[model samples]
Target chain A: MLFSFLNKSVHLHGFFETDIYSDMQKPFYVKILLVATLLLGFNAFAQETDNSSAEENGSVKAEIKEFIAHHLLDSHDFTLYTIDEENNEHFGFPLPVILWDNGLKVFSSSKFDHGQAVAEVDGEHYALYHGKIVKTDAQGTINYDEEGHATNVKPLDFSITKNVVFIIVVSLLMIFMFSRMAKTYKGNMIPKGIGRALEPIILYIRDDIAIPNIGEKHYKKYMGYLLTVFFFIWIINLLGLSPLGVNVTNNIAVTFCLAMFTFFITAFTANKNYWKHIFWMPGVPVFMKIVLAPIELLGTLIKPFSLMIRLYANITAGHLILMSILGMMFIFKSWLGSSMSFVLASALSFLELLVAALQAYIFTMLSALYFGMAVEEPEDH
Target chain B: MEKLIEQFSFGLFFWQLLLLIILLVVLRKVAWKPILNAIDERESGIKNALEAAENAKKEMQNVTADSERLLQEARMERDSMIKEAREMKEKIVADAKELAQVEADNMISQAKTAIEGEKKAAVADIKNQVATLSLEIAEKVIKEKFSEEGKQLKLVEEMVSDIKLN
Candidate 1:
């Protein structure tokens, strides 16, 4: 029965299948609540300190929203926790904050003190205002526009922020892991140890994804990209599950860039056949061909756009739901209610784990599918 | 509007692109090609082994068929040889019987002719002996009659009388 359920779930692919296991839902909710309480206790505590208002403690919906927004944004420092509330003492290392302020400004993010202080360097003052660096007085004075928005001179930020740092760390981890996995191939063809784990996924990308979608002729050329993106996304998603909260794929910029890679590859490598079909489709009426051209052109952009949005939205939503459910545990005053909240939230986190890998798979699969479409030769009708 | 613009920052996009491209190039060389090549090698090896097994099976079948055909041919040759030997033996026996019959007939005819010749010679010898014995007996009777020459004058006269009667 369990095997059948699993098979059915696998067949359903992207369908939300947590409901199908209704029998498990009770225990599932309980366990999820337990785990979510523990996890959210850690994460929520860290975030809750950002706005420790005693009067608003009872009604933290507004604070929870603020905490969630802050959690989602990329910051310059890697602040683990605050040492003292009165002193605003933070315990974390600063990453190099690279920026273009008048001229090139390269300094450690320690100058901003985890967005808690204004930084001064070379007779110029910069304030870390709400996660954006802007030119300001030591008092951090800001002039308001007519629209009542802060008008400050902001520099072009290219800092090694928390997210960027994680990206680099993950990249290095990937490189180290794959290099070891690749090294196993020198003496024996069959992989051993880490290679054993790595080989199947590689072949799956090659045989199942790449070779089938992209023809055998072109699959080799595209295999590298497919493998790279799949592992890159998969590893990043896995990292998101950790306490470090490495939500690289959740960032629109990252997803956009990844989709852009697919888009560019498809555009550059596309044969004459792909363009011909899009521009003046064969076997269709002349009027229909003319009408279809613009839509087809828009479709080119839409494909990558959807790719970007789908990954970003899915990851972001998964995190949002988990955090919200976790926040509900604090809202429930009763032990029973709070326990139930924790359990349900915990269950959702488990689902998020699946969603993380799934989102990665979907993104890679869609990208491959698009690549396949682009390089497809016209069938003789 | 400004928040949205910050999310779509050119700097982040550019960095991300640079990082991703570097990752692709690195992984393609370090990870993908080796792993993919190994898998391909293993698959092709398995295919080659299966093909070799199929060839061996086919060869075994051919060998069996050839041997079976050869065995049948040998059996047929042995059967024909046995039949010819039996026929030659029967013909030899018949020829010997016919020759024995002819020799037996010739011996019987020669034996019969010898017996006939021996019987004729024996009869001729007995006849010669009988002729001598009768002459001897006649001479003895005439001698005894003539010895009595004194009485012959009287007998001669009687004989002359008898000859006149005859």
Candidate 2:
């Protein structure tokens, strides 16, 4: 029943999916309320099951919190769905764990037994503790430092985690879609299939975002990176919203890497005027230049820093709030309260969908803006 | 902060960076290059087609105006030609009439002079004939008068008196 509900929601591309789900001519308000109530009910159920083993005082809330945190983290296995929580049965496939401890130590994530067992590989015992692979004894004992931090030697992990899988999938999907779109160009000027839907978006990035932000002369140079980043984040964000539990952009590591790309590109491609304005303010008072130079320099670093934090925080907060709202249904336990929470959660989900695209657009737009500033030709007044 | 720091995996960052670079490179070669080129080509194609259409429209207008001007010029030329022909015909007719009047006047004057000369000659010839007849008659009368001296003397006296009275 739960799987079917999730499947129906997954197939819902937009809000106009009432006719597909039901034959009855329900009013729009009732649909909204029904969707909200359903979301609340699902959240309550998820909370109940996830917190079943840890049913201590106020355990549902704590479980929901843990669930949100777990959702935020990158995992070794891609858990598609939970079959039986008590029995620890998850209906998904394990990913390959690639680690470099002294030398290469490759193994399947299933060897860790969902982080409950220690795996002995080539006479070396290792355990999964808090989503990190650590060196442990036969008993899988994890030593802690005075600060309660793990003191166990961590292997240099390069595992194909859940997020990595999604990354690979999304990238490959992008290549397939665009290659097919490009192939259609050989036949006629008008695009078809995925190209038809994606062409306008590409043009929007080119005309509205890239060309406007990055001037036409220099826009084409940055189109590859801009287009890639835009669609990458957009698609990743959209996937994150799905029940598939692929919250990639929410990962600080991922966002940090993305921001660094923009930063490095700006730093590398910046013209002389950009540095002049940063390090030594041109067309300014000498005293003011000394004061403003440091600020300007700091601004350059802060720009990408903010870019990283903005995307990470927005996506993470979105997930947190959504999970929390859904979790609220469990605490409410009443029809009215559960329904309200569900409605709020449902509305937020729609908002999140808008945000998914909006964040991508903003990131691309800002990156182009930074590139524009970097390569801007100084005006002669 | 400690947990956050612990959660920060250099491995994840490295992998993300590496994968992103790979994605960027691969996508640039595969997706972006072609899609952008196609879009630009289509845009320029549309622009060129529109410009051609605009030029064709303007050319059509120009051709229409040119044909209209040609028609007007032909009409004007035809009108001038017809006017010139009419003027030439009228001038020729007037010149022929003037020449005919001068020739007719000359012939009439010549005929009048000839008539005057013929009348004078006829009158002179009749007077001469009359004079001859009168002389002949005079001779006969003289002869008869001589036979009859009294009648002759009376005719001579009458002639003498007629002459003295003239």
Candidate 3:
């Protein structure tokens, strides 16, 4: 959100082709006073709540947690923020709910009212239970397991949820961007727009990551997958930082799929030597090789597991820390404490940006390394 | 944590897998090929250009060295030719001087022989002329003395005495 505001205001005349050259010359900080007023109002509201009863403080903390949880979860509707305080009213749009309940049920997620009300379609009831649609009646009574797990029957949901929507949007965005970049390379001219930015990264992945890990002869065969994975993770991680509250990469399902893809590619491309080294140590004793063979096989499975967990944990922790610090401004209930929180939050936000790009690099580099290891030729000691 | 794990959906995996595969294929054809090919082409082109330049420079150096050697050989040849011609000229001048001295000596000897012959012949002719004059004088005296026997006897005795003194 800050980036969009900055891009729209101060740094409009950058290498980006957002508004074209005609709108290049524009003054900076047009909305500074407006932002100041908004912050002032928020501070005043925080003070008012501070002076209120202790009961209201508890509810405020609950509201903050609820907001953070909502931000973290994948929702069927796109809610930017809540507008009204009296009744639960969100200031965003709904998405198409694709479900396989009984038959193919298609409807707008606005019927769920941001998971407040239940949606009844064709004499069947559907309720949003913890960001998952489950079959329920009008009362929306949710059944739970002995361990408090939701035992509601869930259909194979193919809904274009907020996360999926962003995925598609981001996918099309990448497609359009790289495809246009490819077109410019037809001649010997430099990339015109985002291509200029992506060129260095592409070369970096090729030189620093792909070529060095995957050898000169075999690196070309795997560049396509490596490049795609790098951009895909990097872009989604960046989008997660935006005000849209997209936590796609922070989700395990997404990370798991990415790791699985890497695993599948590595397994499929592994040469005979890779298996030989894993199952049978050449120089070691035969008994020791047999003992270590299962561990080596387990290592193959663990590699992707660690890859999935690393990305999921890193991004999720970064978001949690950032949001928690921002939530502290209200919890602090004092100007000094709130200001300190604000500073700490700003610093963390900056770190998260770095972490965002770093995680992508780490993931892509490790994937390339694994690919290289798998296809390495057998050599004498 | 359990709740978070519950967020994973099988549908999402399939969807993401399908999407990523499609992305890989499309991007490889569209993006990676052109960018890489252009770089490779430019790189090799530069290498070829540099090699051509280096070869040309070497060839030029060889040609320059060859021309310098040929020029030096020609200069040496001209120097030797001049030296030989100068030596031959000195030899011819010395031989002509020796031949002129021999001719001068022969002419002087011939002139000396002719002068000596003329002097000897002139002396002989003078002696002959003197003998004839003396015989004529004696004959005239004998004729006068026969005409007068006593004067003849006196002249004969004087002639005999003068002859005895000679």
Candidate 4:
């Protein structure tokens, strides 16, 4: 509903050719929004009655902030939701925990009891505190220093956590899909089944993204990396938006790793002219080269740094805004105020879907652009 | 802020790096290489087919034009042959008529000369017959007169007495 105008303009450009909103009429939109408003109004009124016994409003607001922070963090177990809020009983499965302490130690994450209990393996004690596995005493006591940092001896964690499981799942899904699509090409030119849907997107990346940004001569070598990163980020972002509550790209550590790959690939594959341009630019005054060298060198590192933060902040901020607006439903006591928030939240969800695809495109485009620069041939004047 | 920073774990970063590397290597080998090659081959195939079709169309047009030229030449040849045949027939008919007229004139002149000769012969024969008959009659009369010669002497004496009296 919010992006109807944007869809119209994109349709006019003849890029997509099929506008998803072209068949929808205005009355149908009004009917859907109206029904949503009525449903949200009733739900909010009921919640207002339940929360009437609360002592202060400030405490509730603080709790909401803490809840958002916890939602953004990665965890040792895959907690789908809390069934009993008072008892703190969670409904989800536990993943396998691996650690590198004195030797190899492997155990199920259920031994920690959702971070309330410590796991004992071969006479060694370990506890998951703040989503970090640390060595502790038998009583699961964590000793903190003056700065509230855990002073306990920490072991290297190689556990298969929630995020790791999704990564594996998504990777396997991609391999299965594309390999099947590739198999259809053994005898026929056109792809079959799901490949029919995926062929155009793959072609788009090849024709529009890779060939244009990375020149034809060098684009073939980098095609594997470009395709892998584009689909990986795009699929991961879509999974984050699902109700499964898996936000892998929102983690700074994950984004840092992704950016590191792009940085290393560009650095390793750069030609002689690429480095020359940085240190000693051609057709410039001698003193100007000395002054510009340091800045150009720093620019290389800063490019990937920005890439890392851009993906991380964009996803994290989107999650923050959407959650906060939904949280407003509880704070607003009247039906009118709560219903308005519900409508805003619903509209923002559609926009987030577009941002998910856009972020993937931007990351891949910039990466290809950098690779183009690194391998560019020096032309004669 | 302190707790948020604390949530950044090195283990997660390590795991992510390992998984991504594995993914890139596997996908590059199994998926991208073959798919790209197939698409490229298909595109070139389409281009070749279009060129072949265009060449065939040009050949068809050339064949039609050749047939049309041959048909026009045959029609012109047929028209001139019919004209020559008509002229030959007219000359043969006129020659036959002139020969028949010359033959008729020769026969008529020959028949007229033969008729004239026969008429002259018939006239001469009639003249000879008439002359013979006249001569026979005169001779008979002269025979009769000589028989009367004795009386002629007596008469001569009478003629002499008449001459003496004058």
lDDT of 4 by residue, A1-381 (tens): 113323433443342133212222234335435654666656655567776534544566566666666777788898998888677699999999989988999889999988888899999999977778989999989999998888998898888888888888889999998999899999999989988988888888889998887788989988888888888888988898899868888887888898899999999999999899889987789998997788677777766766776787678777777776676666554486567778988887787788888888888988888888888889722
Residue A2 error, candidate 3, Å: 43
CA shift at B100, candidate 3, in angstroms? 7.1
Q: What is the lDDT of candidate 2?
A: 0.82
What class would a CAPRI assessor give candidate 2's docking? acceptable
Per-candidate TM-score against the hidden true structure? 0.79, 0.79, 0.76, 0.76
lDDT of 1 at A27: 58
Q: Quick one: best lDDT, which candidate?
A: 2
What does candidate 3's lDDT look like per residue over A259-319, in tens digits? 9988999999999998998899678999989987886787787777667877876887688
Range of the 10 consecutive residues with the lowest summed lDDT in candidate 2 chain A: A16-25
Candidate 4, overall lDDT? Answer: 0.79
Give the per-residue lDDT digits (tens) of candidate 4, residues B113-159: 87788788878887888788777777776566456877666566777
Q: Name model 1 segments beyond 4 Å from true.
A: A1-59, A81-86, B1-3, B106-166
Q: Write the per-residue lDDT of candidate 1 for residues A103-210, one digit (tens) a residue.
A: 888888888876667788787888887777888987878778998877998888898888888888878998899888888887686787887877777877777888
> What is candidate 1's CA lDDT for residue A208?
84
* Candidate 3 residue A192 C-alpha distance from true site, Å: 4.7
Candidate 1 per-residue lDDT, tens place, B10-102, comes to 556767888888899998888877877777888898999999999999999999999999999999999999999999999999999999999
Greater-lDDT candidate between 2 and 4? 2
Better of 3 and 4 by lDDT: 4
